[model samples]
Target: MNTKLLFSIAMILSISIITLMCFLSPAHAKSSTSPNIVLIISDDAGYADFGFQGSKIIETPNIDAIAKSGVTFTRGYVSAPVCAPSRAGLLTGRYQQRFSFERNLTTKEDLNRGIAQSEKTMGDHFKALGYRTAAIGKWHLGNKDVYHPNNRGFDHFYGLLDGSRDYFKQVIKKPADKYKVLQRNGELLTETTGYVTDLLTNETIDFIERNKTQPFFAYVSYTAVHTPMHAQAHRLTAVPESVVDPKRRKLIAMTASLDDNIGRIIAKLDQLGLSENTLVVFLNDNGGALTNASINAPLRGYKGSTFEGAIRVPMVVKWPGHIKENSHYDQTVISLDLLPTLLAAANAKPIENTPTIDGKNLLPYLSGANASSPHESIFFKYHSGRAHIKGDWKWMTTKLKQADGSKKLFKFLFNLKNDPAEQNNLLNSHPEKVTELRLEWQDWFFDMPGIWTQL
Candidate 1:
């Protein structure tokens, strides 16, 4: 062979090797391709309860750090005003009403029913993408054989199946059966010693430790600041006794403790060198319960209502290098959006025959690729009450019974941009707006298969 020809071939081989290295390196390929997802959901938390949301008393440095490190959504909302239906929407990324899950699960009969088996959950999608998935904390979806977390695509499950559990220890099983109890992968845990929040956080850390080398999805659904407002005595030292209301003080302490646990989870991710690639999402399942002394100031109504205070929640998403730090997204976003957004971040695709996802991939908007809002309109329905938001306009109807017993419907129209609290009723002034939104809602409601029969 000629010397020039031999040299040419050698150079070509060297170039090919360099190209292959570029494609295989961890910096540009392999582990860097898919990000880990940590979805943290709080139960019955108020809209303005956390430090990032402008709370004066509650100190949530860890939760606030997520907000400062990424994007904080001001108009974030849950699909439903209450827990079960809201969670149904979150887990499935679709309006819960579409699947006939519109109310809080109240009985064993309801417990038997949960997110339909046919529906694909975020966990199922992540698991299909070759990622480990675990659900630790509250699993209010269901306790039935088909609805268990193991069947719902989680490899590990540690938490309560019911709504509210005692914060400390004692378990009551006699009278009404409303008390919450611990369950680990369908087996009843006779006694879980430590605080539930701290225990769940430790379990989450363990899950991360076991799966740190691979991509994993951790759904940390905390049952904190909910009912059974029992905060650890040590956590309440900062809260003053001058605050005469004991429930409020306990709730404050619970909020503080939740904040601390959040910090612990983040610290664990950082310690494992996983913080940069981990997508941490923080949000509440729904608006707070007034009976629990939750503070939802600057918004109207409480947990079960269709108002902004009930549906709108505090939400923060932190993806170290991908999303801009310390930013705010004011346009409407919902809990349903989490599934699609996380799937996009993880480079995963939805399963075939998956139901139509109501959530939009929020990456474009958060990354400034899209200037317009992710969603043009959002709707809500519970019992006989209904609400619809299109652009800045909102139309809602409230059911009020007369002195005798019959029901009366009171409708109101408001421009949320101007009157976020719904203090001024514009129904009389803007009849056309009311008609347009009402018709829009009616069209969507007809397609829902219509679930509010109990009302």
Candidate 2:
């Protein structure tokens, strides 16, 4: 070979070797694993009640920061419109209905049934994968030992065991908040005369600090903006004089406190240099208060109903570098997606080899791996009735018929993608599609007898 040709070939070979070395580096390797998870679940938050969601009301900068840092779900939904069922789905990877969980939760009385250990939780999956798991705030899953957060794979927990409690006083006169002062595992924290948000935030920061060295799964559920709204005087006093109602201002104050708590946690992560290594997710358990009117506007209906406003919620997930920032996705994702999504990111496996969960891993769909939704057909059987989400079409109706086979015909079919307002009803126009969707729902109901609480 000529000397010039040999020299050129050698140079090309050197470039190829350097390129291969760069590809082999750990920094550029394909990753199936992700960062530590910080799932912050807010209680009874509204859909359009945040700054990022075109709301002129609540100023939620910390909430908006999660959206700006990663993807925001335009049509994010919860498993149920109420508290308990939504927690059931959020904690586990399947719809709450699938476990026969209905109603807003009651205490474990003589005959009351609690969340069974038969079904594993997201914490269990992470714990199995060697990640430190801790649950803080609002553990209404159950009151019994079998259903407690400690028994359900949480290494440490600090929060309520009941459904509702006062924020400042942390107790309602009607039902005593024994669950409020109750603490199990980890140090028992007394009511420090501080705000609930601040207390919860401090516990969350402590959990992160304790587990920062190793991968941790922190489930920081906040019982804020629920009812009997109470916040510090300074936070509420900051509101402008013009836009204020005594009761409404109280709600705003509570919301601001929640936002501030989130800000503290984010700041702690940054300060500890664990921000980039954390996959933070923020979402509301269910829709906001109905009669109290937490303001779920532009969407009809309210909490406890199977309407858009009842279950639709604001959702944001942030993971630096992996998930693109400032991205908004319109996919119909539900709260059940959280369990599997977290497990997939953590590379965790299920315990005792339980049956396949109802939720699909939404990581691919969220990270732009595929164009379609993780769920093509989602089911909702609230109480005892049924609802279906197939493609853009939403079909729902009563389970039983009246004496004349025309019972309370609560049927509504809407193409949510085009008419997100749910203004136009096409049940009469699309009887065929309704029939098809109904059959699919029937099959699902029979297959999963747990959809009904009695079953």
Candidate 3:
């Protein structure tokens, strides 16, 4: 080879290195080198809907595999009972109540479903850390372009901007035009005939293939099992019509599709040689609804209620090398923990001048060095009434849904550990505990934003 030719090759390589550094270096993106993070969120999945959580009705073998391969939190929790607010809390790592967020993401009816720009999100932090981020599937956090996923640190955004859309419709972005789907940051391609769940999985797999060479963050938010009752026919073959009740058959179909999609993603992770290196966190946005016939067994109340059914959710984290396999942690963990945990795993430092975070890094707690509860007391304020859970005692107002579609708040207390089903109300027996929790809730809500939205 001639010296001139060698020099030319070196020049080209140096330029390429500079360009790559501009995109991946911490000075440019504020991130540390770590494993890829894939967050798989299910919409409206019931506590007992999956097999791992003691459900016999629906068979979710692949999701169960994550439990066998990683850590499963028995007392995992979501911040809210609804999709929009729950996501807001999860992404922001703060209480949605702290910002007076009470409505769905659909702003067409004067309801804004997204979070305010003032509050920082996990995506924002990750993006700063030089990670290429993509958000696939349901983005009910916001419908407007300014509030879209791309605008909030995600470099790529696919799926519907609205909470729900027609599944079979070939065109989601431009249903009338045929195959032109909404494309934000050149990531999402409009589907023409595939089921929504399958389509989401396809996009995710495409992302993995495209960005496998570098660190990437994929947020696959499955819009499964939420209202519209539409799912692909292929994934719903084994259901017995008798067992699959008429009112919930559509939901069952959606659930099956979601499971298959998860299977595909998990399979792809292994195929792409990223399974052991990727940190996968699976969770539901909120509690199940009786309206959809999702039974939240072994727990009282439903979605939008201040019961274990509403807040407690299935949280599984799988990272073969980092987390212990087949381990179950009984300590209560919150959705807010995701932010610090992910950053900690990535070796990314927190911002110096940020507000106080209500979440704690679960690594130490899960490892058993930390003995205290994540929070000594947790405050719950749905409406005018307030409740607090401290140690084993819980005090709250029972807002019974009346026949006329109104709520009747009844104040009471219960020892959750003693009576997990909340069958026994110890308000009379434990007056002191109730008083203590009440004082705590009041003080917590005092500095909160101007309260409204309560019915």
Candidate 4:
């Protein structure tokens, strides 16, 4: 070969090698040190409502895609059986009862009530690590400014301050209509067009695109299929023909919209080449609600009850390269685990002087590095009712009203592994097991403040 031709070929090979190296270098790829986090929460959703959870009627292709892409916890639970407290537990990584956020806010007088200001939220944890955080959709934590998302670690907030609102309309019909108006950061949006589910999704995509270069924590809280049975008129046609009830059809339509938006968020992540580096978690705030025409079939009771139907929710976590696709974790997991898990994923330490986190970091367990369950037992306390679960055994205490306006306390036990329905109460049969669980529950109960203690 000629000298000139040999030199030309060598130079070409060198250029090609450098190009490949640049394409694979850290500068060209997403930073693994700070993974973006997107937490998508649905309000009052059913356990058996989505395609991933074996639903044949209500199609949730996008949500199912999340399950297909990562791990689905079959025995997932939330700290509370209701909205406000469940969210408190999720964001704080500790039981809401620990901070005296035990019940839902009802009247205008309860405006000041919220997750304790001292507690750090998941957004706080991520923001401390330099993440640009935004909270979209529902903010049922509190109506007061002190408990606002901006004050609770999120940099931007756009959503309702109350627990529920009209999805299509946001006009203030009265002086006490503060919860009806949508707030963008600190400003209240007098008017908003389009459905809320779509609106929230748009904000989420916008946040991701604007902050693609930096780590962002987008909390997409959707109050869909919650109440008033409000859904886009055209979406009703998308519901299955088999669903005859009008209310149920509306709920199905709302769920369909929610699923579509979730798909959009995932698509946005993929489009920005952040899918592999973003941790996306989808779960319901609690379980299906009685008023929303939701179906928590195969599980007993509905929202506000301590049964599996109220507490057990459909939870899926997706981190393209970290969590194995199409994986399933049958052992118990809770919404409280989110903060610790995200912190672990980002290699961020817990905030200084914060209370001990009740949730365990689940990365090791989800990655199969550890075979044992993330928790030895999980406890639940709502009003006079309480429950404790250890291994496959579950013990519960329910408060029932008598004929003469008196309340009666009842105890029940069940081997959840054999009977998940909670149909057979083994309280009498397993007296010793009940004693063990009762004692354990008492210890947990005493450690946390009493109901409305903070108020």
Error of 2 at 342 (Å): 1.2
Q: Rank the candidates by TM-score, best first.
A: 4, 1, 3, 2
For candidate 2, write residues 1-455 as lDDT tens digits.
99999999999999999999866643233222447889999888777778888878789998899899999988788888788888888887876656677666653351255565567887887777667889988888776566778888899888877766666654435543465554656334554456777878888899989877777889998988787677689977887676567877777788888898899999999998988888999998887776454888788676777777778898999889878899998878888888877777765556676656877777888777887877878887676546788889888754444788774747888888888778898999999999989899888777565433431
The pairs that clash in candidate 4 are none
Q: After superposition, how far is residue 49 of candidate 4 from its true place, in Å?
A: 0.3
* True-vs-predicted CA distance for residue 433, candidate 1, Å: 0.5
Which of candidates 2 and 4 is the stronger one according to lDDT?
4
Candidate 4 accuracy as TM-score = 0.91
Q: C-alpha displacement of 312 in model 2, angstroms?
A: 1.3
lDDT of 3 at 158: 76
Off by over 4 Å in 3: 1-24, 27-33, 106-113, 170-183, 186-191, 241-244, 451-455
By TM-score, the best candidate is: 4
Residue 15 error for model 2, in Å? Answer: 35
Give the C-alpha lDDT of model 4.
0.88
Which whole-number lDDT from 0 to 100 does residue 345 have in model 4? 87
List the candidate numbers ranked by lDDT, top first.
4, 1, 2, 3
Candidate 2, which ten residues in sequence have the lowest lDDT sum?
Answer: 25-34
Q: What C-alpha lDDT, on a 0 to 100 scale, does residue 224 get in candidate 3?
A: 78
